[model samples]
Target: MQVIDLLHTATRELAEAGVDGGDLDGQLLLGACLNKSRTELFLAADMEVPEEARRVFLRYLERRKRREPIAYILGEREFWSLPFIVNPSVLIPRPETEFLVEQVLAACRPRRGLHDGWILDLCCGSGAIAVVLALELQRDIVAVDISCDALAVAQQNCRRHKVDDRVALVKADLLTAFAAERRFSLLVSNPPYVSRRQLRQGLDPEVAGYEPLLALDGGEDGLDIIARIKEMLPVIMRPGGEVFIEIGAEQGPALLRMFAPSAGAAELVKTVEILKDYAGRDRVLHLLLSGYGR
Candidate 1:
């Protein structure tokens, strides 16, 4: 059938199946099967697709119809404008997470003697943050995560970005395996902040059914892990060191209260600012420490 006919049919099918971006997904899948860019796909709209190519495109359409994420189908996702391989093993890096990286870079630029020190990326996922930070600053990084599969994907990303030498992967529950004496100049994390209620209430099928729950379920209140990390600040950060943490949009105020002098680690914190994403939602926390860790 003609390329346009095929796209038109698939788009309708996917849309009926309740997939968001169905038409765009159809275009992308059609372009992939035909080995053409979107522009080429449009130009070739009236051309006939070979039989075998159409079959492959049909399979991709079926996957999307089932709500499989496009990133997993494409086997990669772009973050910080660098492509990183992805799978069911890790959370697909989202645009909002980039705010965390930006804040880190912003905080790093003004701080003297910030270069060359070790950095930490907790709950590292696809190592998106770790890879970008290492490449952006040339600092050695120690990235920790609990899943072996996630670590494998992260390793591929580190190599893909040629930051493997500067990035170290560790299997750990938070910073549990880390030596108590080791301290870092910077720490960053995009931990699982989705409460069980949020998941039970419902999520996009692409996320609810396909994405790793280990990376999404943040506990009953979603603050379990975030709070644990807060208490451990003194163990990992050096005096004047900073941290960038990505949180659920509504969790920022509670996080600020948690880190305030009356309730949390006020003695160690020098400043705390919750930065907003493009949507104006609280997305990242930029915090600096006032003293060296034990």
Candidate 2:
């Protein structure tokens, strides 16, 4: 069968199995199997695929038919205009997290000593935010994650973006693993905030079965990690520091209340702002902090 006809047939089959962008997915799978670009695939539609190539592509199609994410199957995903290596060990970086990164970039601007100013990217899955900030802002950064496998992917991405020299990668849960002396002017994260109830809501197979549970399950109420970060804010941040976090859409007010305190080690000076994703859901939390109330 010709490649174009095969793609049409595959797309119909995939769509029946609930896959969107069926034709694109089919083309990508075939191209990967043949080590050809999509344009090449288009040009060679009439060329016969060898038996070996056909078999390899069939295997990938089988996985895609099961609703496995194409990114995981491809072992890479692009975030913030940069390609990142991804696997089940890490959560797929989402466009929503980009808003948090933007907030940090804006806040971190106009501040002196940026070269020496430290930025900590907590739960640095795929190191998307950390690498982008380091490369774009030329700031020193430390990216922390609990899973070593996830950190490995993050490291590769850092290298790909050529920010390895500016960013330090650490394996730790939140900020707990950092030395006490380590303090940052900016702290950012896209921690797991999906509640158990949300998970029970039956996620897509691409998300539920294949993606790592460690990167999705957010404990009973989904604020477990966020709370921990709040408690450690005092020790981990310098004076007049800022934090940018991505929360579940419904979590903005709750998080603001939890982190809000008047006479504490890390007083919430003001809620700088909350930003919504393209879907119009509140997804980012920005907090301005002053150390131990001056």
How many clashes (backbone N, Cα, C below 3 Å) per candidate? 0, 1
Q: After superposing candidate 1, which stretches have Cα over 4 Å from the reference?
A: 292-294
Instruction: Please list all clashing residue pairs in model 1, or write none if there are none.
Output: none
Residue 11, model 1: lDDT of: 82
Q: Candidate 2, residues 1-294: lDDT per residue as tens digits?
A: 667776877798899999899999999888877888899999998988888878777788888999988888888887888888998888887777777787778767776643344788988988989989988787788899999998999888888888998889998878878666636878888898899998988888889989888888888889898888877877767767777889898987777667655434235454455677778888887777754556
lDDT of 1 by residue, 163-242 (tens): 99999999999988867663787889999999888988999899998999999989998888988887777776677778
Q: Compared to the true structure, candidate 2 yields what TM-score? A: 0.91
lDDT of the structure predicted as candidate 2: 0.82
- Compare the candidates by TM-score and give the number of the best one: 1
Show the colliding residue pairs in model 2: 265-292
